[model samples]
Target: MINTFTKPKRLYQEIGLRLYEELSDSRFSVGDRLPPERDIAERLGVSRAVVREALIMLELMGLVEVRKGSGIYLIKQPTDNSLNNELESTLDNDDVGPFEMMQARQLLESHVAEFAATQATKKDIIKMREALELEKQNIEVLDHNHDADKLFHLAIAEATQNSVLVDLVENLWERRESSPMWKQLHCHITDQTYRKKWLIDHEEILLAIQQKKPDAARMAMWRHLENVKDTLLILSEHKDPSFDGYLFSSNPVQI
Candidate 1:
């Protein structure tokens, strides 16, 4: 039997689409107040966090209004343009392109580094140093050390004291692992040169944060991601049109 089934969606995304459908069906009229997160969560047999994420998606799509301390309200329908925009976002999550993920990481992590420069304590610095050490050791053993790499970045995000930024950083890293483009791009990195260069880049970022130099930290993080983006592009150039040339072949390299 040839079974055909779509991949399962994340819990929150499934709930988000259900909520959107309810709104589209006019079950919740414009300006009508939606139920509280707790009520919705209980009714749907899901956690409040799931409902909250779903509502956030609606809010982002301009379909709902979240009034502080009041409640969520239906603000508008998902217009054609909004639906198109949300469709693109959904597809990105399913199979985000490596370059798209890199661009998002550069924008978010640069600020995370800057904030960590001012906010990181001695403990955070120690953790970052430990992660960096692990990365070096793993590279020496040809282990790739992806978890340690993530820890180094996540440690900086934690130092920022912003939960949203931390989640954003975590989300980007999670997507990187699932991105087909990213996996294909990494297949070209069989040698240690890139890893060695990245270790030095990580050290520069760590030093800037340790010295509490916000601007330097931001620039260092930016350069690190920029180098990564360039490397991906160059490596992609070497592959056949079927592998990478479809999406990035005609795109100009952006800093």
Candidate 2:
């Protein structure tokens, strides 16, 4: 007989599976509030970010409800009969890891910026300028969902005049939008302060591209993404001395 519950591939999925097994036992009951994210992280010897991702998987599976600024609540029991369907739902929507997505963007877009610095025409620069302006307005209005952010990124890719690069950037965004795991990660984050820092990073990227300095543009983009990854990982800090470090490298490149 084919086992309905397949093995987990990602770190978050593995954590989610562990939690699911715990929930299946008599330890937890319906409508009960689970332990705090910090406590869970300490107990599991994993980062709170990983625990958050696992909770998100449970949320997607309709097994728990994640109330912002409050706590996760058990919504439904994880019975074997329903486990197959719920597990499939969670797996389908969370096929990609959030860190992996950011790493890909860092690699691809940094090079795209390098190419943009060389290939960008006056018209391309104007388009990028417009996107940046729109992003500024969105930030000023305190808009949590910054649709213009993607526009700026796509503009950078488009400035490269490489159709394939534009398509790749767009595809990455599409994947992020469709990802339940990504959405879940953002749901817990209430701080809007990070947007301001990213805006400054955007300006640096634009300046380097406009100057036609490929090396500067590449480094600026690389640093901006490094900041982004760092900000996200701050939530995943593990105080446990024995806890293993992050799944991805903080600084993969030397320069």
Residue-by-residue lDDT tens digits, candidate 2, 76-128:
88876766676866654446767667878999889999999999999988987
* Reference-based lDDT, residue 12, model 2: 81
Q: What is the clash count for each candidate, in the order shown?
A: 0, 0
Instruction: Please list the residue runs of candidate 1 whose C-alpha ends up more than 4 Å from where it truly belongs after superposition.
Output: 1-93, 239-255
TM-score between model 2 and native? 0.78
User: Which consecutive 10 residues in model 1 have the weakest lDDT in total?
Assistant: 240-249
In terms of lDDT, the best-performing candidate is 2
Error of 2 at 251 (Å): 2.7
Candidate 2 clash figure, as a count: 0
- lDDT computed for candidate 2: 0.79
lDDT of 1 by residue, 15-56 (tens): 777777677666877888887665677789875435655665
C-alpha lDDT score of every prediction, in listed order: 0.72, 0.79
Models, CA RMSD each: 16.8, 4.4
